[model samples]
Structures are given as C-alpha cells and as structure tokens.
Target: MAMDEIIPPPEVDLPRETEDSERIIPSPDVEYLPRQTEDTERKLPSPEVDYLSRQNEDILEQKEEHGKTTELERKEKQLKEERHGEEHERPHEELGQGTKLETQCEEHKRLERQCEELERQRRKLERQGEELKRMKTITIVYEQFRQWIEDKASNSSSGVSFIEFNPSEVDDSVPKDQNHCLGRGGYGIVYKAKLRNETVAMKILNESSRQGEREFKQEIAILKRIRHQNLITLRGACSEKFALMYELLPNGTLEDRLINEKQRESFSWEERVRVATSICTALVFLHNAKPNPIAHGDLKPGNILFDDENICKLSDFGISRLLQQTNDTGTPNHITEVPKGSGPYMDPEFKNTGKLTPQSDVFALGIILLQLVTGQSATGLRKHIVDKLEGKKLEKMDTRKQKMILEKLQILDAQLKLDDTSIQDAVKMVSLGLRCSNSERKRRPSLEIEVWPEIESMNKSECLYGSDEVD
Candidate 1:
C-alpha cells in the first residue's frame, strides 16, 4: 500500500437510494410486499436469536423423530397439505397469536356449553315421557269409570239399558202429540208431559236447532231448583238426541195470551195486578236465594206461565249467572261479558255496567206493572205516552215486548175516570211504576218492605189479598 492510500475493502458495497433516485430496492434474500393488505404477514426470528439457534437442533431432531418436515421444508410441505386444515388454520394464524388464543378459548367454552345444553334437553325429554305415561293412565281410568256407570244403569232399568229419564214419555200408549212429544214448543204445540201424573210444561226451545237442546236442559235445571206456586215449575226432564221435555204449564204463558189480541181481551185489571204482584214476589225470592242469587235472566211475559188456580209464576233461568260478590265490585265501571234477561226488562245498570243491584229487578217490575195496566206493549201505547207521563213510561218500559196485545179492558175504569173514583189510587200506583223506571239504578228503591207496602195496601183496600180476588 502507498503511504497516503487507504486500505481497500474485500466486499463490494450496494447502492443506497437518495432523493435523486426516489426509490427503494429489496435484497434477493427477502420477499418484499406493500404496507397494506388485510391479511398479509411475514415471519421473523425472535429477538433472542442465539437462544433459538441453540434449541434449533433439538427442535429439528424432535420434528424428524415425529416424521414432520424441517422448518425450511415445512413451508413446501404445508403448501402441499391444502386439503385438510390450511383453509381454517392459516387464517387463524394470520390473525395474530393473541387473537388466536382468545378465539380458541371461546371455542372450547362453546363446545362445553353445547354439551351441557344437550344434557338439559335429554332431561326434559325424560320428563315429557313420564307425563305421557300418566296421561295414558288417566284415559284408561276415565274409560273404566264410564263403563262401570253404564253397566250399573243397565242392571237397574228392568233390562232397558237406557230408559230415557224424559217427562214426555209419560204414557207410551197415548198418541205421540197427545202423549206429549218431548220436544214441544209454543201455545198450541205445547206437550202436556207427565212424570207420574205430575204435569210439566214440555216446550222444546224453538229459536235455533242448535240452541234447542241446550236451552231445554238449562230451563229444566232452573225449573227444578224452583218450587213455587207463582213460578212455573220444571217437574222433570228427558234429554235425547237433540230433544227435551219440560213440566207442562197448563194455563200456558202470559206471553202467549198477551200477544194474542183476543186472548188478552179476557185478562181483567184485577188479574193483571195479581200477576204483577206474584212476579214481584218471585223476583224477591230469586234475589234473596242462597248459594247463587238468580236474576230471572229473561223475564218476559211469554216466559211467565199460569197454573190451574189462575196464579202466576216467574220462570226461565237460562243465560243466568250466579252472582259472586267479589272485591272487584268496588271498581265503579266493571262489566261482565254475560248479558241479562229479555232486552226490555233488562235493567239500565246492567246495560252500562254489569252490576246487578236489586233496583234492576224493581225497574223491570215497574215496566211490567205499566204493561199490565195499559194492556199493551209500551211501544204500541198512545202518541208520546212516555213523554205524556213525564218521560216516566220510557224509563219504566220493559225492554221485552209482549207477543200478544195487552188486555184493553183492564184500564177501562181508569180511562173512564169515574167521579166516584178519586183517581188517587190509580195515580199512586202509577207513581210507583215511575219510581221503578228511574234511569239511575241507585235512584230506584230496592224491593224492600217500604217499596211493596205502598202497593200492597192499595190491593187490600180494594178487597184484594195482595191483588188476589176475595172469592
């Protein structure tokens, strides 16, 4: 070397980029890529390269013993393992080790939860199986019970397995119509059914064929519970394939006579008053009855029937409910879905709010009294009769209209306005009718001693025993 000359290097230096070239070059040893790629990565050695180098031999030996490829060879071999795990494992590995560990832990927990869920489902299936077995047992028991009852009935009825417990089968020897067909209805068609000579009103429900049987059975149950001279009683029942019989009401129904112009003409004012009084008594009984207080449900003149003694009785308990005095009554505007009685006789309180107070029955009674005295349904009365009576007639009119015309002669005395008749008696009775017709239920007096005493005194003054004839 010359005294002033520097020593030359053994290796050649590579060119470096600068502002002039404005470019970066990659060495042959590395695979270069752009900065951005959602899922691209490059493998790098750990910072502790010396420690890794020392362990490399052991790791290599372990891989070889396990028949796995060396690290350098692994890349080529892994690429060839395309079919089994790479689609899943490669993506996971690219995501970073921290994410992979968390994902793996979550997967382990999910599998464990799945196993627990499967166990719970198996237990639920076992419980359902037991329930099915119990249901099967219950069905068998019910069948056995029915069989036993049928057998007992077969033995008791003189070899006739199903002797209909019907009132219509009174005397099998008589003509079918004359013998009282179980399913009888209306005035002329009514059957005089006999249960051992005790007659019953055998009216088959006439409205809907579907409702006939149900209505008959319901009527029977209602009549059976009631034992009154005033109320048409149900003596016995006979239920068959959509057929029924009731204890016959020999005198027929007030509705039948009232609706008929000629028959209603025979009704006297005295008889009308008597009928009205009897019905009020019946209502009192029903309202005060124990266990389940009834509200006639449908108290139309037609549903009213007379006995041979010319006495009236209230009948018909269908579409009725047992009044349950519950705490819920405190709510001012509560209503039950169930409806009450015939439309006209139905109380206004029952219309707005389903609270059934005794005043409701009183309201209906007031209308009945008016109908009896006027001898016609309120609808057919004089021009603005309701208004003429200070709107009292409208509020007092029963929603139920009589099928027959009212007795015209009953009000003859009042219409005549005889000088001997002070007319005070008629006015007082009419006032009672108006009081019953009050729209506000609370305004109407309950059917207590004070309410009926006024009317009863009038009947006695006319030599009537609560509107009954002295004879």
Candidate 2:
C-alpha cells in the first residue's frame, strides 16, 4: 500500500451525539443576539424588551419595577393600620371626658343642697332662742310675785290668812243652790259660800277651763298687791280647786243695771258722769302701775262692778298685758304680731299696727263715755257722732245753731229727761268722746291733761250751783 493510504487506514476517535449535545446546536435560520450596553440600559423602558435582546432587558426591568411596587404597597398598608388604630382609641378617650363632666355636675348639685339645709337649721335655732328668752322672763316675774305674797302673809296682823286650802274643803264651803249663784262669767261661776265661819263669794273655775286657772292666779296676785276702796276684796283662795273667795258686792255688774229697764230709768246723767270719772281714775292707777304699764285688753260693761253705794270698780284683769319700755322713745308699749280686744272698743291704731299704748285705753274710755251720755249701742256710736260733727263749725256756731246741732246729733237718751245743765254737760261729754275716739291716735287728747280736768271742772260747777241754790 501507498503511505498516505496507510495513514487514512489508521483509526481516528470521534465524539458521540447525546441529548445535551443535541440541545446546544442552533438552527441556521435563527438570528444571534448581543449583550446589553450601558447606553441602552439608560434609555426609556420599551415594550416586550425591544424584541429578543430587549427581551432579557425587559425581564430585568419588570422584576425591578415589581420589587419597587411591592415596597410601596407595604408602606401604604402600615400607614393604614396606624390610622385605624388611632380611630379606634379616639371614642374611648371622648367617653372618659364625658364621664368626668357628669361627675362634676352631680358634685355641684350635692353642695347646693347641703347649703340649703344649713340655712334652714340656722333659722330654726334663732326661733328656739327667742322662745327660751320669753320663758325666762315669765319665770322671773312669777318668782317676784311669789315673794310678794309671802311677805304680805308674814307681815299681816289681821285674821286674814294666805293659806292654800284643800279641794275638799273648798267644795264643802260652796252652796249648791241655784239661788246662791251670783253670776256666771266666761271662766267660772260665782256663788255665795261660807269660809272660816264668814259669808263670802266664791269664784269656782270650770273643770274644763285651763285658761280660768291662769286668770284666777293672776287675779290673786293683782288683788294681793293692790288695795282700792271701789275694787272687790279677795278674802281667801284655794289653789288646788282653782277657787277664789272675795267680798261680794250686792249691786252686781254695770251691764245688768244698764240692761234692766227699772235700773236704767233710775240711772241719772249725774250718776253716769260720776261713774265715768271713777272708771277714769281706776284706769289712771292701772296705767301708772310700777314695773310696767298694764293694758286691760278686755274692757266692757260686764267687767265693771258696782257696790251698794253705787260706787264703780273695774274687774277681770284676765287678758291684761304689761307693756315694755321702748329704748328709742322711752315710751311704754306692747308690740305683738296680733292685738287682742273687744271689737267695738278696739283702738283703731292698735288694731292696725299691733302696738298697744295708753291711747288704746283712752279709745275704750271714749266709747264708754259716749255710751253713758247717749245710752246707745257702742257698735256704731263713734261713727254716728263723727258723721253729725263732720262739717259743723261747733266752736263758731251761735247759741241757736248749737241748740239745732244738739237736736240733730240725737245723742240725748230717750230713757232720761235732762235739765239745762245736764244737756250742756252731755254736749261737752260728746265732744270730748268724739275727740278721744279719733281714728288718728295722735289727735286724741291725753286723759290726765284734758279728760280728767274737764270732768272735775264740770263736777265743781255742779257743786257750786247746788251751793248757790241752797244759800
């Protein structure tokens, strides 16, 4: 063989075709792609990665944009969670504030109520303090009265005694006969009784009358301290039975005499004037009483008593009041929320103002004076006199006019026939009565200065006239 043929004939080793090797082979029709440049990376993003070579770039750009979008979404979710947490906490904080405000309002209401209760308690204490002071004054007055009674009993040399009797002894002395009963008053019955072997009058309080017992004690105290010829004399007293023994007056009360036709017929104008003067004197004594001035709250014909000699006396000091001295004017007065007195004789000023003064007694006396002179009912007597005297110039009138005025006044009592002097006296008394009963208290004349002087002058004139006639 030739040398070249001999070399070809020698065995050469060749690689075998496998699956991985077959995959590495490229088709002849496919185009080749190059790596991305820096300038191409900086250019605007393209669709589909600018074809094959741009495909790899497009994939890389998409992965980068997806990463950035995920980061932004995570941050937005975190922000949303924080806002939701704040929204949930806000309502609880507002509820806490509202509860605090309600509690404050309730506390304020409780404080206001407490303040009101304290104010009420303060007022109650003030009222109680006033009551206690009044009771203390009453106790002092009672002690003084008791001491006076004891002193009188110890100093007395007469057979009269101030011993308190038992109820059985008082009852045994009293007569049960209706004929023995002298009179019946608001508080008790007056009866003829035998006490200590002496005939005496007994005033026995009704069992139901608690006020009568107080009045009885008051009467005893007043009688023991005061002595008057015209006043009834207290003989003895039974405290246990609420009974009082007194010297009986046979003539009875002024009311009984005034109402009786026979007695009224015999009651002369001169006698009426005397009676009026006597009552005025008694009132003066009562008004000037020591320690305090007294006001007889009830003054009526029934409370005026007469002796067999026709002498008048005032009685029944049950409703009497002791006036206190005022600091501002040093005038004696009794100031109260309500004033008590008989309606017809009540002082106009005292009724309206609740202040009892000496003028109050003067007003009552005026009514009594008018009743004595005219023998008319006291209810409308003052007004009748006022109406008749309203426009008349009494001081300036002539004698004829004065006579006509007197006729028009209708003040003369139909039961009595009066003389010229008595008629003139009646006119004078009516004038004085009208003056005293003036609605304005300041206009009323003073009893000591004007009333008593006029009465005394009239009495003196009558006595002088009688003396001249006798001579």
Candidate 3:
C-alpha cells in the first residue's frame, strides 16, 4: 500500500520554487474565458530577505577585521613591555654614577671647612708667638735700664767733680794721638785723632799749668752737664787733662773758610747767612738751657765750624759759663781766656768786668757779623776808612755798594761816633749788628726772634757774593 501510494502522481510535474520569485496558483471553476490567459505570473523575493543577506555579510567582515586589530594590539603591548624592562635596568646604572657624585661633593665640602679651620688656627699661633718674643725683649731692656738708674742714684758724689773718664761705645777700641792738632785756643788745643772707625777732634789741655787744670775741670763739668745738637758732641773724656773727643768736622773754622780766595767761591751769600743763623740757634739753645742758663764767653768766627754736611756747630766750650738767675748786667763776655772770649768781638764793658751772660754772647756775635760782612779784619777796616767834612766815611768809600751802610755810619756818628764803630756787614746786617752790640745789654734782641728771621730772609734770596759787585 505504501509503495502504490508512493508511485501515484509520481510523474505530476510541479513548478519548482525559484530563487528569484514566489509563485501562487489561481482559484478553481473560474470562467474559462478563452483558456484564461493568465500571464506567466512572477513574484520577486521580499525586501526583508535581501536586507537580511546584506546584514549577514557585514557581520562576517566585522569579525575578520576585529581579529586582525587584536593581533596588532598584542604585538604592540609586547614591544612596550620590553622597552619598559630596559628603561627600568638603566636607572641602576645612573644611580651608581649619581651616588659617586654625591659622595665626592660631600667630601669636598668637608675638606674645605677643615682647611679653613686649620688656617685660622695657624694665624692665631703665629700672632701669639710674635707677642711673646716682643714681651721677652722689652722685659730685659727695662730691667737693665732700671738697674743703671738705681746705680746712679746710689752714688752720693756722682755729680760733684765726679770726673768719670767714661769711654764711648763707638770708640772703645781706639788709639789716641798726641800730635795733629786741628785748632788751638786760650784754654786748650783740638787734635784730629782716630777713635774706633771714626775720626774725632781730641781737645787736650796743658794740665801742668794750674790755671789750665782748673779750667779743664770746669769745662769737663760743663760738657757732662750739657747735651744739645748745636753744641759739640762729647764722645769721651779724660778730666785730668780735660781732654774730650768730638765728632770730627771735615771743613775747618768759619775764619779759615771766609778768607780763602779759592774756597770762598763756595761761600755764597746764602751760606754766609746760614752760618749766622746757626750761631743764633746755638746761642738760643745755651741761653734757654734748663737748670742754669749758659753764655758762650767767647763767640767768634774761629769757634764756629762746618761739618761734612756744611752744618754749623759751636766748637769751643772752654770759655763757656753757666750764668745764674740774676742778670749779669755789670760783666762782659770778652778777652781774658778765663772763660772770657777774644778781644776784637768783646764788649767794652767786658774789658773791665769779667762775667758772662746771654747779652755778652749776643754782643760778640754782632761783632763777628761785622767781620763776616766786611771781609776785612778789624785792623784793616780801621786803617782804610777815613772821615770827611760831612762827618761820614762816604768820601773814603770807592763806591756806594749799599745805601744802608752809608746811612748807618751817619747815624752812628750822631750817637756813638763813627771812629769807634766798625762799619761792617750790609746796611741791614750792620744795623742789626749794632743793635746787638749795644752797650746797654737790655736793648739787645733775642737770638731766635731778632736774628734768625732776618738771616732767614737773606738766606732765601741769596745771590752769589760779588755777582752784583764789581767782580
């Protein structure tokens, strides 16, 4: 039954459904209207079916693109991880270098501080050492000086006629000379002698003569008491002979210098005035001396000398005397050699009274001033000059070299008379000298105030002597 049923209608051909369309059959018993020309009906597939197929293809492509993207992303992640590992390892290498730098910087800072501290300590130590050395030297010097003072104080007869023939440290190992006398005066002679490495003037006395011995002791006492720059330096002494060594002056006395024709060329007007100023300076120093004032009993050109530096120093102290507080108005500082000076420059009062004072020295210096200016010895000037009808020496003068000299002589004739007055020096210098040489001692000017200022003026404007004259 099953086979038969299966064969039936086996051959009945049915229209196959096509992919492009869906077919539908018409209703039965419909009017055969000329074999009902039902045109071959075709139905296209539905729009929904085409849309579904396009969507399926799009989904498949999306899946393939996603796989490729995932593969590429994984490869990128692996590469990044490898780079991160390398970067992580590099930090260790840099860390080692950084640690070394840090250690070096710390060490440098520590060393710098250490060096600075060491320098500070060194400076402190050096300063302390220097201070200690200075203290030790000062202590030793002070102790020695104190002991010397104490010894002097302890000796009762230390000062009174305590003629200590002390040797000079500078001349401790020197030999003395008997001859080679540099100068001779009433009291003594000055010998040029060697002392140690230096040349000195050794003033010796005739000790056999009683008068000379007395004077020698007096001079020694005076020299020991007085110390000044203007006075002669006392290197050492022997009180018995009244010998004293002095710093040697290369040049000789003012007298020897002024008169020597060849050497006189160097004695310019400035030098002459300078010499005069030095005399005044020495006089002032003596007059104002503390304890007792001193008077140079003899002030003369022969006693004044020039050093190697052409500096003036008062050489002869043999005639010098210390004047007490009372003004020695009655005495004169002239001619006697008993601490009394020379004749030509002596005050007339001194010719009678034998005493010394500041005024006495001033008077003598004034006379020397005249001798220096005239370049004529007192004997020559007296003989050459002549008084005329006008009662002045103008007629006797060959020419009027200066106006002050002529006028001064006229005035002196009216007062003291020209015959006795020695017309010497320039007009101004003569005037000053006359004032200094005044018989009335009180009328004399101070050495510093009166003499030095004028001498200084002349010194500053000095023209060579004879340059303005009839050379």
- Return the top candidate by TM-score: 2
Cα deviation of 110, candidate 1, in Å: 81
Estimate, for each residue in 1-471, the C-alpha lDDT of model 2 and write its tens digit.
222332222343535777666565443222211212333346445555557667778888999998898888998898899888888887888888989999999999999999899989999987777555434333333343345457756876533545566788897988878999988877688898877777777888877654666677777777766655445667778887888887667787777767777888888877888777767666666666677777776777887888777778787766567788888876688887867777788998889999888888889888888888777778989888777778675545555565566666776666767666666677778878888888888899866556765664566323322233222
Q: Which lDDT tens digits does candidate 3 get at residues 268-332?
A: 55566678766775676667566777777767778888788787788767657766663454332
Ranking by lDDT: 2, 3, 1
Using TM-score as the measure, name the better of candidate 1 and candidate 3: 3
lDDT of each: 0.54, 0.72, 0.60
Model 1 lDDT per residue over 166-203, tens place: 43363352346554543233312355545444445444
Give the Cα error of residue 176 in candidate 1, in Å. Answer: 4.9
User: In candidate 2, residue 83 scores what lDDT?
Assistant: 85
Q: How do all the candidates rank in terms of TM-score, highest first?
A: 2, 3, 1
Model 1 segments more than 4 A misplaced:
1-190, 194-198, 205-221, 241-245, 256-265, 328-335, 338-340, 354-357, 380-383, 390-422, 461-471
After superposition, which runs of candidate 2 have C-alpha atoms over 4 Å from their true positions? 1-163, 208-210, 336-338, 393-404, 460-471
